[model samples]
Target: MRYRPVAFGLAVAALAAVSLTTPAQAKPAASSTTMANTTSAGTTATRVVTAAIPFGQNGDIPVARNYSGDSRYEIAVFRPSNGTWYIRGVGAYKFGQNGDIPVPADFTGDGRAELALFRPSNGYWYVRGVGQFTWGQAGDVPVPANYIGDSRAEAAVFRPSTGKWWIRGTAAIAWGRSGDIPVPADYLGDSHADLGVFRPATAQWWVRGAATIAWGVNGDIPVPANWVGTAKADLAIFRPSTGAWNLRGTSPVTWGTNGDRPQPGNYAGDTGTDQVVWRPSNGTWYLRYRVPITPPPPPPPNCDPSYPTVCIPPPPPDLNCGDITYRNFKVIGTDPHHFDSDHDGIGCES
Candidate 1:
C-alpha cells in the first residue's frame, strides 16, 4: 500500500497546514506545529515539524534520513511529478524524476542514511555519495537493505512476475509468490537485514532464516522497527482499513487514517521508537512523537556570588534585607547586598 498511490483520506482534515511548495501561508507561530493531544491509550505526543507536501502529487511519502548520526531522523518529501524534494529541516534537493521510487538509505557505511532513488525505468540505482549502477529490471520493486551488516544498505529488488528476490552479486532466490509485498529489515537482531515478504492473501510473513508469523491481514503494510529496544526488529503492521498500527505485545494504536504511510522512527531522540504516519492526501504528517525532556537553564550571569542559595542580581541601587525572600541563608564572598552587616556567615539574620 505504501509503494503505490491509493485514494484514501487521512485524519488531518481540520488542521490548517501551510504548503511548502506553494507560497507559504501566513506563517504559523513557533508552537503552531505543537500537537499536545493525548492518544486513546493516554499517551501524549508533540509534533515538532508540520511541513506540507507538494500539491496535485499526493502520492509522495515523507522520506526520513538520519544522516546527522544523532539518532534523530529528519523528514524529506519527494515529488515524483517534477523530481523535487522538500526536506523539512534541510533545504530542498532534486535528484530523480517521476516514476523513480525513493529508497534513500545509508550506502557508504557512514553510520547514517542519504538521499537516493531507484529508477524503475532503466533498472538502475543512483546513490548520493556512491555512484550510479544497475541492479534490476523495469517493474521490479526496490528492496534495499544492509545485507552484510556494514551499516550500508545494498541494492535489492523483488520481481513480481517471478516472485523472487534479486540481490546485488547474488542469484535470484525464490521465496515468495506474486502479490506478496517485499519487506527487508534487520529482523534477526544481527544488524543485517533479511529478505522477507508479506502475503496478503494469507496474512502470513516469511523471513529468511527466521520463523514465519501471521501477524497482519490483507491491506496492511509491513513497518518493522526496534520497538522493544533490543537487538532484533519487532514485527508491526500498519492497517489502513482501520488506521491502526498493530504491534506485538502492545496495544493497537490508531494514528493516521487510510492512505497514510507508516513512518516509525526515533524522532524524540529517546530510547523507544516513535510511531509516525504521513498523510499524502493533505500533505500532513501525524506523529505519535513525544517531546524530549529539556534541562533547566543556567543561573543568571549578573547574579552575585555571595548568595549561592538564591540568585541575586548585582546591586546598582543598594538593597535591604527585605528586598528578597532570603533569610538566615549562607552568605560568603563580598556580600554585595550587605545583608550580612554583622560580618556573619548568614545573610538577613533574624
Candidate 2:
C-alpha cells in the first residue's frame, strides 16, 4: 500500500523580490534584502527561477533568470538564521535560449547540493562543484541520483532518441520500452537515489529499485514525495489540464494553474516532502506546507584536529632486508610504508 503522511498546516505567499546583477557582479555574497520572521500561517514568499538547489543545511536556494533582459541568471539563497531569502550569486547561462533548466544534486558527497547545466554548444554537462565533462548524447531530461549506493549523486539522462536511460553515476545504462520523463528517487528508503521514469501515455510510473513496478496513470511531470510517511519517496503527478495534484494515498489537491512548475522538497524539515510551485506567469513561488523550518547543519566530518585532514596511516619506510610485517606500523607519508624488495627506488617493486 502507498504511504501518506499527515498533512501539516498549509501556508502560501509571495517571496521577496530580488535585484538583478550582471554576470561580472554575480559572485557569492551575502543578501542585501531585509529579513523578517514569518508567521505560522502567513509568510512572504520569494520569486525565483524555475530551478532550486537544496542547501543541505535544511534550506533551499532558488535561481531566477535575468529580469533585466540579459542572458545572466540570479541565485537567491534562503538564510535560515534571519528567516529571509536573498540574491546570493549571478552567472551567465546558455540554458535560457535552449529551454533547459539547471539540475541540482549532491554530486560531491558533501551533503550540499550543487547546480549543473547541460551546454548544448559543447554537448557537455557542466556541474558547479564538479567540472565539465562530456555526455555526448542529446537530451533535455536529467535525473540526479546515487545509483551506486555512494553518497555522491550522479547526473542521469533519458534519451528519447533511443528510449534508454544513461546513468553517469555507475556508468550503467538501461533501456525502457517507453517514457522519457526522468524520475530520480530513493524508492526503497536505501539512502541512495534510484532511476525512475514516468510514461505519460499510460500514466504509469516505473522505478528501478527494491519495488520495481508500473503504477499510476496519465501522470505528467513526475514529482517524488514521501506523502505516505513511509520515509520512502513515492510518486505524485501534476495534471496541467486541471491544475490538480494526485498524490498517492491522498485526495487530489487543486493547487496550481496551468504552466506552473512543481517542485517537491522537505521545506518543513518534517522529513516528509512538501509541495512548492513556481508560477512563471508572475515569477512567484507558492508553497504548500507549514512555516518554513531550517534543519541544523550536519556535524563536521571526522578529521585530525591538527592536520585537518582525514586520518590515515603514513607511508611505509623503504626497506630491503626484513619481513614486511616489521614495517607494518611505519609510515613515510600519509600512506603505509612500502618495501623495495628489488633495491630499486620504486616501492613494492610493482
Candidate 3:
C-alpha cells in the first residue's frame, strides 16, 4: 500500500499543546515546548516524539504527544491546590478523565492493548481492556478527614503487575483483571499503587520507596527501592548493594527470598513510634494492590560466552504508522530528535 510513516515525533509534540486547553475559558497561548523523540519500526518505520507542552495560561496541564502506533500514550496532570499529580491514558483523541482509556498495544506479548485512568474525584484508578474495566484505590491518598480545595489530584502512568497500566497517586495502587477485587495490604509505592512489583510464587505486591516494601498474601516485607517497574512481570529485579529494583511492572507478583512477610512502619508517624506490622494482625493499616505475575529473570542474559551468543544489531528506523499520523504530524515539527528506535524497551534508553 506504499504508506508514508507519519511524523510521530513532530505530531505528538504539536498536538500535545492543542489537546489540553482549559475548558473554563480561552486563555493566552500556551507555552510551546518539545518533549522527547521516539522511534518505532516494523514492516514500515518512522520516528515518534512525545512532548509535554503547557496548554493553558498557567501551563499546569500536560498532554501526551500524539502518535500513530499500537503504543499507548499516558499523561500526568498536577493539581496545584494539593501539590498532587495524577495520570490517565487509553484513549486516542481525548483524555480518560473518569474511566479507562483503551489504547491497543501488545506490551506484554499478550496480543492486546491495556488502558487505565486515575479519577481524583473518588480517589480511584480504573483499568479497561478486552476482558474487564474496573476501579481500584491507590493506598496512601489521605482521604483527608475534611474536604479540600477542588479536591484536585495528580497522577502518573503505571504498568501494573497484571500486565496492564496502574495509575499512581498520593494514595494506594489497585490492580488485577477488570471486575476483580484488589486487596488492601498488597500494593505499594507512592500513596496510590503508582509503582510496585509482584511475586507470582508468593503473590505479593512490592513497591519502591525509601525502604522498598514487599506486599503479599501473607504480609509485606522490606526490600531495596532501587528496582523500577516494567512491562513484563517478575522480570523486575533489585540490586543488593545499591538496593535498586529494575523496571519490570507494577504487579511484580512473586517473592524471591522471604515468603510474604510484613515490613515495619511507624503507626503514629513517629520514627520513635516504630512498631512491627503484619496483615490480619493490622488489616486496617494496610492497603492492597494487584500485580501481574512475571517469569524469572532471563538467566542473567546468558553472560556465559562459552554458550552460543546471538549478536543483535542496532535497531532499525521508526516509521510512525497509524491513523493519527497526519493529525499528530501537523502539530510536531522535525528539528530535535526524541525517539527510542532501538526498542530495547527503554524510551530514549540512551
Decoy 3 TM-score against native:
0.21
Q: How well is each residue in 54-156 modelled by candidate 1, as lDDT tens digits?
A: 3323767578767577888776677776566666655666567787788888877787777777877777777764567778999899988888777778788
TM-score of each: 0.68, 0.55, 0.21
Model 1, position 281, has a per-residue lDDT of 68
Each prediction's whole-model lDDT (CA): 0.73, 0.51, 0.27
- Tens-digit lDDT string for candidate 3 (42-144): 1222121122222222323332211222322233333233222233332223324323222222222342322333343443433232222223444322111
How far residue 72's Cα lies from its native spot in candidate 2, in Å, is 25
Residue 35 error, candidate 2, Å: 30
In candidate 2, where is summed lDDT lowest over 10 consecutive residues?
3-12
Off by over 4 Å in 3: 1-67, 70-115, 120-134, 138-350
Best by lDDT: 1
TM-score, cand. 1: 0.68
